[model samples]
Target: MEKNSQAVFPNHQHSRGKAWRWTLWSVLLAAAVLIGVLQILVARAGPILKGRVVETLKTRFDSKVELDRLQVSILQGLNVTGGGLRIYPPDDVMAAGAKAPLISVDAFEFHAGLLGLVFKPMHVGAVHVRGLAIHIPPRKMRQQGAAKPRHLGKVKIEVDEIVCDDSQLVIGTDKPDKDPKLFELKHIVLRDVGPNAPWPYDAVLTNAVPKGDIHAAGSFGPWNTESPGDSSVMGDYRFDHADLNTIKGIGGILHSTGHFEGQLDRIAVQGTADVPDFSLDTANHPMYLKTEFSAVVDGTSGDTYLQPVQARLGESDFTCSGAVVNVKGKGHIIDLDVDVPAARIQDFLQLSVKTEPAVMSGVITTKTKLHIRPGPESVTQKLSLKGGFVLKRIHFTNPEVEDKVDMLSLRAEGNPKDAKPGAPDVHSLMTGQFEMSGGKLNFSNLNYTLPGASVALAGVYSLDGQQFEFTGKVRTQAKLSQMVASKWKSLLLKPVDPFFHKDGAGAVIPVKISGTKSAPKFGLNLGGKKPDQASR
Candidate 1:
């Protein structure tokens, strides 16, 4: 029995070991077959799933969608890699074989949760995009009922984070053809963007046009897909040490901080621009400009209404309220009502005239309505200005001008009855109704009264050439009039006695002053010749 038991034990142990090995091998084979079957299912389901995703995107975005390649990594938590993803405009908007696409991506990657496939709400993990391009067309005025949706209507896309590595944006205009504006963004990251998420999102991006790193927080839509105009967005942005030279017409280094809170359909903004060292192509000197303004901007028409706008350029202050319509277009119109109640002419000497110290003193008051239209080849042909000017207590100290009226200070005499008791007097050196027409400045009713003489001049001055043509009657003081009367019979005065003798209280002379701004010639217009002919 012992021998038989030992032999049976050995055989039983051997048979059991063999059975264990066989079971282990069979389990390995089953696992391998299951893995093969899973791979086959993944290979078969990838294209079908990718096609369904493409169709879902097309149906949700109301656009044509295309994908070049779709890859799945089953070992990596269902990671997805999409190459050459493109979205085009709607079929109704795009013609056959059109090349323009709304959005394009070279490559994109994301990890999708399998639970969301069968669950209620889909949640996608971080999505990283590379080489993205977006094109924005210039606003076209559509009729009232022609509004379009901005985002997907019925679909909800919840993304934990979206990172864009390289992106380019282009903005272009269709009418009155102009160069497009291009902006490049690098390393743009956005967080918590979805329909059910909070409207405020965190953004970090680097803009190439203004050359700054922009950090912003904004509240955008859970978009109303039915009515895009009903969506509203607002943002607060800040950029420090931005290079303004990259932008058109501006050249300088600046810091910009502003907030834009408004509807996207009809835009409005209230902000302030602070420029420490600001320079433009049209300006001579680099200045500090600070402006605070509230404006309503038309999204479609590109027209802006700036009301109660306050601006300060250097030492000058301005409050301009008006609209500039169709800016930089063929039908550009600027209708601004500008009021400069007190602006120092000396501050802008480099912009206009070159003068020595104290050549002109006192503030100038100008109220004008500007109506400018495009001329032949955009030369500003019909530039007209109707305004009045008042120069208060102006002092003149030029060598050539002082020769006629030495160290003269004059103002328009105010009526004593209109002055308050013991109050200081209000005096204006020159008061005139001035108009600009046909590239010439006309001062029809100008009065300049001094202690020794009073001059009334009416003339037209060419602004472009700085040429003056003026004819005025200069009345001398009482004492000088008596002396000139006594010498009227003299040889020097014999040729022009009638010019000084025919006037009332003083000796009046018909004088013609005609010259360039620097060198003026004064003479008697005895033959009443036109100032232009007599200047020769």
Candidate 2:
């Protein structure tokens, strides 16, 4: 019995061992077969899969379309390339093939997929695109009450490159006869195909015609998709050898280099600009200065948006705040709550058509605003300007006196009278009932050379703030006639007119202005009718 039991045990053990080995081999073979099956499915299923995607799109939109080049491949496990791509317009317009432009993407490669190893969220991948051009026709939109969906109402499409240099753009149109300007991209250049687009603005643009050899680069981050405000941007913008501005008179071999970095939603910016020897039509004619500019701009609030903006022109440091300088096309004004603590006043006055050069000097402090708005609003609303200017020390030009009368100093400061200081969102320091009735320019204690006559100007302006009709007359120990006759005549000289004479001798000039708020008509004539000739 013992011998028989031992033999049976040995035999049983051998059989169990053989069974275990066979089971292990079978499991390994199955796994290998499964992997092979998956590989085949991936290889053969690409065309079918792409077709299904196209079919899905067509079905969802209720349209009939076909694909030419249907190719899909995976590096690790992501779409890399797809070719023979084309789009067919609706079938109803099949007879009008001429009007319907076809769309095409040459070679499209996509990268980026889940790592799926231990733990990693975002996938990283880069796309490589070959020559791609698409002639996407316009959509035909059906009229109201139509039986079919919106796609039936769409129109044909036409595509063309409007402006191309630094930027390459493909514009779409409804009809071949339609204007090519329907859609446009200012400029675009493709450097590295990226999942993140509109990146590297510098890699794109090349020129600015009316401006000059233009080079631009900027950074834009997507924060809130709706308002893609500038979160942070650093770019060098250069306009080489541009023409001087007719109005600004800042002309010459112009060159500027600047960099800006800051947030946009809660706007903050800091940058430096170098305009070396940027010539001005006026004298100290040509001046070169490097400006370091920094500001916290509030875009959310009107008051905050209207806050002060500072610029250091050359060695001159000035703060400009108040009123908004609305611009239209070529015309613009420094209209707003704008002030200059220590600005060269001569630079401005000389730009006007004056018989003799009026050299004035003063620290300008004025509450003023300008307008050049061209829009649906009335001209008055478009170019509406209502604010007063305050001049502190207005020095007239004079070679004889210790300080020339013409070398005037003006100190001005005025706020929006009725504007109530806004909430924390706004940047209004003070707000209240503004005399939107207009503004007041108060020239207090104007001290002149000899007679010690102080010039005082107090005037009320038009609703748009363009016209200043006030009781402004010369007051001095000497008669108004005497003050003008003495100092002004010698100053007038021979090159100028006799009737116009000098500043002090002029008549009690009345003022009137009327027009759009932005472009009001101005008149100052005491020759005939005092009231009829003026109205603002």
Candidate 3:
């Protein structure tokens, strides 16, 4: 009986151990299945999740927002594509028709750490924005009475890298009469843009202003989201070999290379500009220029000012300051101070007129304070130049005058360099001093002397119409009177020589030259002398 009982106990114990093993295997399999099912469900719900994200953005943002597609993944953060999102201004702003929301994009990517996103300070690995466009509206002064107390909002944005490709910016003016400007940027990349970064953010972008690549590095801080106008910004930007043809009003400048380092928010700035090859096409000739300039610009008002502008052109140096003021809509006032210590008339004429090299010769010095106000139809018609010009050792070459005067021959006869001490030489030069204002040149003293004749004149010349009217007398030395040909002596001097002799030396003749610069008529005043008496 004992042997039979022990055998049954062994069998029963073995059976119970087998059942427990089966139960443990079943539980493990069920848990594995549950996890797989949950993962499948999450994957299937991606579209629903994308919709929820769009709704959340619309609810949070004040402006209109839409997204075409949002792809979520456990391994990858978010891949947003297809759809240009536009944010329209508020109803009231739209009504004013001055503000517009103009941002569009082609693709974007966002990456964030899971634990960092929910726990402490959020840390984003990277964010890339591609094919973006931002439109800027023109500046307009806000109504003083309508200004409200501004409150700034805190900005909480961080990223390791932000990249933009194929972007554009449009800048418009508040005055609809003015033209808008456009800028195209390609391949913009930025790095380490976040709070408490180890170093300032570094950025690179292509600029359309001068059509060149731009590199920048700067520290950007605690940004005020609402009142960004008051935000402080500082940076250094460099642009190399930018074409100047894109700019207005100074399209003659071919190329420019420069750098700007300052606060962009203020009106005051300082920089250096170097124009390697600038060419200007004038009516008569073309001017080539190379300039090295430095200045402090203050643009607090509607117009800007460049004080103490220094430049070099050809063999001449210039130091001037200019201002544009009282700019309302289209026209403005131009005030300039020009001072040239010395310049060559030959050089000046080469740039201003089509003339022979030896036609005009002198060393000229000029000082002027000029104000040019726009006229009804012209910019310089109402110009006023208050200045003085000094010309030393002036000489004029006229083949016609040389033949009639024959100064060289007369000099040989009068000062036969054969043993004459301190003998006067043939005079072929003059000195002039004139006061210029209101397009009129008043020559208070105009004197020139030749070997046999001399002239002293006081007259006013009109620049607008190219008219010259003078009351002067020509004085001939005794030797010159003997050399004077019959035609001039009889036709001109014979009529007024006696009357003019009372006030001057030599055989003086009152002469007048009138008409256009191209065609001049010479006449004698005679001054009450009877025709028959003058003939004699």
lDDT against the true structure, per candidate, is: 0.61, 0.38, 0.51
Error of 3 at 95 (Å): 11
Which numbered prediction scores highest in TM-score against the true structure?
A: 1
lDDT tens digits, residue span 1-536, model 2 = 99999889999999999999999999999989977966775676465455554654354334455556555445466454565555544454444332432334455554434232112322324434343343333233111112444443221111111112312223233343333221122443333322234344443333332245556666444221211232244555555665444223345455555454554424444545455555433233455555455545332221123345555553455555543222323222334454556555554444221313433444444444544343443233344444443433445343322122221111001111221322111111111111331122222222222232233323333332344343323323322233332355535532332343345543233333334322333444344332223332
User: Please, what are the lDDT tens digits per residue for candidate 3 over residues 1-536?
Assistant: 89999989999999999999999898888988976864764465355444543443343333356666655555554333334555443333344453556456677766554343333334556667777776543334211113334332233334567677777655454554443444466666556754333235555667654566766556553432222222344456565677655543123333334433322223343445555444222212445555444443222233446566665655666666777553445455778887878877555555533333434566777777868674443332455666666665555454443333344335323322221332333335455566665546667677666665666666665543355566566676533324344556545545554544554454565665555333434566556332223333
lDDT of 1 at 464: 42
How does candidate 1 fare on TM-score? 0.70
lDDT of 1: 0.61
**Deviating ranges (above 4 Å) for candidate 2:** 1-201, 206-256, 259-269, 274-291, 294-308, 312-316, 321-335, 351-356, 375-395, 398-451, 455-474, 478-536
lDDT of 1 by residue, 254-320 (tens): 6666676665445677777677776543333466777888888654455678876787767878787
Better TM-score candidate (1, 2): 1
Error of 2 at 18 (Å): 52
Q: What's the best-to-worst order under lDDT?
A: 1, 3, 2
- In the order shown, what is each candidate's alpha-carbon RMSD? 7.3, 17.0, 9.4
- Looking at candidate 3, what is the lDDT of residue 108? 74
Give lDDT: candidate 1, residue 27.
Answer: 100
